[model samples]
Target: MTAQANTALAAEILEVPHAEAAAVTRDSRPLRLITCGSVDDGKSTLIGRLLWDTKAVKEDQAATLRRDSGSQNDLGLPDFALLLDGLQAEREQGITIDVAYRYFATDRRSFIVADTPGHEQYTRNMATGASTADLAILLVDARAGLLEQTRRHATIASLMGIKQFVLAVNKFDLVAYDRAVFDQISTDFKALALSLGVRQVTAIPMSALKGENVVYSARSVIPWYEGPTLVETLELATLRSGQSTGFRLPVQRVSRPGESFRGYQGTVAGGAVKPGDSVAILPSGQVANVKQIVTFDLVRNAAVAGDAITLVLDRQVDVARGDMIVSLDAQPQTGLAFDAQIVALQPDGIVPGKRYWLKAGSRRQRVQVEPVQQLDLKSGKWQSADMLQMNAIGKVHLSFDETAIFDPYELNRGTGAFILIDPDTNNTVAGGMITAKRTELGGLNAHEGRVILSLPADLAEQLLATELLASRRDEVETRRVTTSAARQLLDDIDG
Candidate 1:
């Protein structure tokens, strides 16, 4: 397909599929990825091999690794996991405990790999890594085939919007390079990926410790198998993009650096914006035109998602930290109630109807979260639940005292995702994504409470005479006020 067609396909992937966010697009930026699987599945070894073969490892670091390992693996190489597992406890326990990020590059591409822990206890860390990744490398032992943890990791990656998956059937050498075993494992993983609604997948069989099929080809020993190496798959992978959604800039802060200059500063979270475009300050629903798009370097005609720029409005408006600046035509949803899915990250789990701080972008507000359903990994189903335990993935109901603005997570990851923090400890307890707004009040729109519409007096009367308006005439309260009064009301609501 053409590059333009590929770009369009990338945009399409970020949209809602099956009420869940599917594979998000990745672009020219460095690919962000995570290594995930069951414990002792060679995740770290795969990464170390990538770094080594790519020549990303320095002599000093390799020397340190050799000394720290005290012994070498059968390949006459220092313990490869040593290159990533840096913690003292991790080295002693021979397992990864925290998420370790490493940067490496090849002639064709650059990569930021998050080596996530394999144990169930550190599942939270894995989620953190998956949040920003464009692809996931799911490792599994060739002998063990697919395990519960393998399923869990794949599920979380899919939920986090990862579209591309690489199944690394590690330790093929230990399995005597069994072609049948590799074929079976790949077949099982393909079914799992298909169930997750992920169609972009490539499975490869290799021994990471022996450095076969990681950075190099595996056809030498496994003569029957023919496929690209692990490095080649990643090199061809894409990075996630936020430009598919309409223009959105979650105001980080109101910048008034000097008495003469004032602007709203923040990174563009979605779409693109330029001067002369009409924009809306949301939650307040105040409209303004983009007077200027300011940057430290110089002014530009346009800025797309991920660009950091200051916006100067033509006239003063009630915009503050947490308020969203978006294109008027493509406004996001504003509501008092929303539905979400979350992964409980703390041991305390999530208590129903408990108020916590919900932070999304630069916006932070108090929210009451109630668990609605918990995911059953074994059966791949969701069951009703009143509360969620640590490492539990569940759906929830969110109640806010004030207006909450969001796009469905599938439409825009930046504005649609959030985190819940424990008030007592200020610890982030859960990572979540918004599913949709709850419209509970009898056909009343989710973006309810108050609305201001301007129309000719005769046209308004003609509208009130309609059947729909006449049916709910008692519920409709009409008032007329000067433009000044309307502005004051909006400001009061914002406050």
Candidate 2:
């Protein structure tokens, strides 16, 4: 058979031979990414450029940009940053204050890019964006080099389990697009990333405003550089391989629109799922088989990592939004308590014994701050403390009212990340991840007390026996004589 015939046959088999109601095809996989950097570092501009240069932006949106071009302050060019400045405050302040989401696709892949705020005060926003991102793009200014904020952002990203990083040295035009400046920034950032436990770092030089080396290569400008452009790097980047040891799906919604169908919808947190796959409903541990996976129109026999679908079960099961569906073979963890490292972002310090809302994936539970360890950003040591201050990175012990499925932040990014919100104010004060468990009792005792306690039997005997033992013996004899005298006097009086 011809190659085209074989291709067509394979496509037909994928569409038909599989259960017509549930099919597995190649068109469903997508990469979820988050772009993070300090404010004014061109994160929004880069994303806007990526969309425009790739023709991902619609004609009407492009026309809007063209109409607003005359009002632009910078060179009277199309203000690409306008594409992401969704809020009035953001446009006025010229900074992204909250997390903004945008979707675009290429022929080979689709993307969900989260544009996060970058100010020191908005670290919680950055953490929220980074928690679910498979890849992180860290933008650096060529003129500024590696600032403290850059290091802090990278550290937070690494702590959030973002393994893949793309370091885009933006504003190359400001530095005259010098290769030396780019190399210096790249080397310095790489060293910082290595210390932060980042797995891979790819550095690319680009001018986001000028659209140099963004979607296409800037051969004329940077002839000395031989690597791929920012777009090319994203396109060629490898997807994370290896099946998840634990199967987890956080139930986002449950639907039973009619008698013909009943389904639970959620993004697959980890591992794989298929029709007939045995899954355990979390918080209850009831077992059932996946009957079918359904989306808006596409129903799939199987859904792997990152696929958002509705699952129909073989047996009637008690499942609800915020409850987790996990594989029986790889059961999800359930406990009312766990430990996490939280970066407190609110001005009011995190108080102990205060109830805060813990949001992990689609699950939210009431959790209390049991204890706050000291901020470690300065000394890199966990010290004892009662509360966490703004911009403070510290380890905390949190106790939830109910148990939920969780993975170590080191293992699964989707399952292991969480945030702390003030229950009364509904303000997110801290963002954290479960690093390790503080299982030992009296764990905080070691950090307290100015002097050490030593109860040595031999030492006690040496001091007390030599000084007080002899004196106490005479006093005991005197007390016994007085008691005998008192008894003799009482007998005489009775007689």
Candidate 3:
């Protein structure tokens, strides 16, 4: 496109009146989302476009950006990427180093978007953004298609429990708006999404540089594509909720004002609780009944997820800080050894047989980390590893001296996730998610010289037809899995 065409497109931006307060009628709480992909795939550019089109960028900042970026592009838009990449290191290197969080809203709803780094070395930083996101916007360059880094970002997002995805095929104008290229990339990514247990996805061709199909529709440019703009999809997406499991309240403290009153105080992490409900104090194996739900305002009858309240038990139990109070029937996993997937964050990678402080929810315990396998993000394979280097994703066995409590990350993200804090420096070394409790011996589950794989029926059939599997057909066993089973298989691959 010529500069004239670019100028015409730049004039279509719809600016919000103000940034501080959004008077738009909201249907729900602000949707927490993240934008991530391969390096130079327009992550920073896409977020800049989102903020620019929404008028979240202040006039003063915009002027500063134009000055700092040296000169405007052909489109007359200051290098939008400079609006993000705020760090001096990032600015010097022309890369995003840290997770830059920004807030913006439209007439329909509010949004909290985290623009994460796309480089392989910053994988840990990307995981930080994904940890709290409800949905993920994975951008792929139209000219480059899907890179290895794109798959890595998608894997991290899926493991972080992001169910919804919006595949932004960015730089479409650079590719001359080729329908075939967009369709091929979209198809490949959808397959990858399915392999990761993610199903809800929408693919749209866009040009972040031209401000097309970001907050504004690209219908005028690409008449064949008639999907909602990026913002529209996010506004209509579902928010993740942690209320699917049983009631869980990791006691933050015991509120004791006087001798007559005693209650366990904490935010409800999962499920619900009310008066007369049967609850159990985990790791101690003591049970009690909820006598009252006490809040600052009044004695409430019930409390659900996100609610902070003090619980008065009918009888005295050994409940204290770090002890979880949960429903009797639906309790989280409690054991001495558990299996988990971790991303090493610090420079001094996670060492095998080293003890670290594992904090999940309000519970903290000393656990030994044994590296079992490392993930090959390119091929989606798990390979044996003894230590995890920085930004490396791996599966490990966690062994605690006493009891540890957790839920599978797929079930409840709040109680299932943990961080490994180095005992020497008190620095966080890794972030992890519990996969399962171990009931067998040894740190790794193996099949000797043979390999076993749980895969989709079609993929499995293709493999069976290959020479490697076809020759050994008598040794293979196949079983049709339910939808839930298929997801579990995908979740088990690396994390």
Candidate 4:
């Protein structure tokens, strides 16, 4: 096409009426979204275009961007990537290395966008961003199509429980706005999305640099395509609810204003609470009735998820920070062992039987992490793994020194997520989600309180020599037997 034809197409697309966009009337909470793709797939540019088209960028900021970018694209517009790649290292390297969060709003709704790094090494950061997102925008270059990183991001977002997906086939202009290429990529992504049990998928062809089909339509340029713009889809998308599970509030503080007042303070994590409701203090199993719900402004008769309030119980109980206040009828799982999926972030990765600090909600305790399997992103398979290296996603077992509380992540994300902190370095090493409480007998019968160990004689002797064991030698039973005798005993038990 000639330059005049390109200009005409652009004019037609721009002149298309905004009345075609979907209408969203209700006043809903802000929708959280994440942009992810392979390296240089235009994640930053997509966000920048959204901001610029929505007029979220100030004039002085735009001028500074123009000055700093120091060059204009062929479209005579400032480099949109400069708008979001704020870190000095990112600007210098021209690649996103960390998660950048930005906020913008349309006339219909508001949004919080997390632009995550696309490099495979920063996959942990991508997981961190996706954990809280209600929707995911998976961008792919039109020329490159669906790359391995694209599939990896999609899988992580789905596992993190993001049902809404928007496949932005970006840089369509570079491909001469070919509809067949767009359709092929969309069909391929749809198959992937279906495999992940995601039914809400919207695929759009867009040019983030030229601001096509982002906040506006590209109908004139790509006359064969018809769908909601990215912003329109986002505006119509529903917000994920925090009250999907039973009532829960992980105590963050205990407020005692004076002799007359005693309350537990925390943001309501799941479900709702009202006066006269029976509640329990977890890990302690202390039960009480809800007396009142107090906030900064006044006492409320009820409180729901997202509300920050102080709960006053009918009677005094042993409640403290890190303790969970939950509905007595629907108590959260409490056990010493749990199964979780994790993304290893540190260079050393997750070592088998390594003790680390686990923090969930406001609670922190020592835990031993054991890797069960690591995901093969390219093949979409789980392979047995003893240790998870950097950026590896794996399924693991967590054994805690003390009882831990959690709900399945699918039921309640806020109460089901945790982070692992390295004891020696004090750096966060992994993010994890509770899959289930490791139970025996399919949860039909309770677990025995005793632990049986089988070890070599030398190792057993070394373990028994530790100060901890030496102090409690009389507390636990010990036995010594030959391998043949041990085998015979096991055979007898089986018989």
Candidate 4 lDDT over residue span 99-201, tens digit each: 9999999888889999999998889899999999999999999999999999999989987888899999999999999877887888899888877767778
In candidate 1, where is summed lDDT lowest over 10 consecutive residues? 15-24
Q: What is the lDDT of residue 87 in candidate 4?
A: 91
> How many residue pairs clash per model?
4, 0, 0, 0
| lDDT by residue (tens digit), candidate 2, 309-394 | 88999988888889999888887557766777777778886888888889998889888886556645433345778777786766
TM-score of every prediction relative to native? 0.83, 0.71, 0.85, 0.84
Best by TM-score: 3
| Residue 287 in model 1: lDDT | 92
**Which regions of candidate 4 are displaced past 4 Å?**
1-28, 441-495
The window of 10 residues in a row where model 3 has the poorest summed lDDT is 11-20
Span of 10 residues, lowest total lDDT, candidate 2: 471-480
Where does candidate 1 clash, by residue pair?
25-240, 26-239, 26-240, 27-239
Off by over 4 Å in 3: 1-25, 440-495
Question: What tens digits encode model 3's per-residue C-alpha lDDT throughout 205-311?
Answer: 89998889898888888987655678877777777777878998999999989989999999998999899999999989999999999999899979998899999
Candidate 3 accuracy as lDDT? 0.85
- Residue pairs in clash, model 4: none
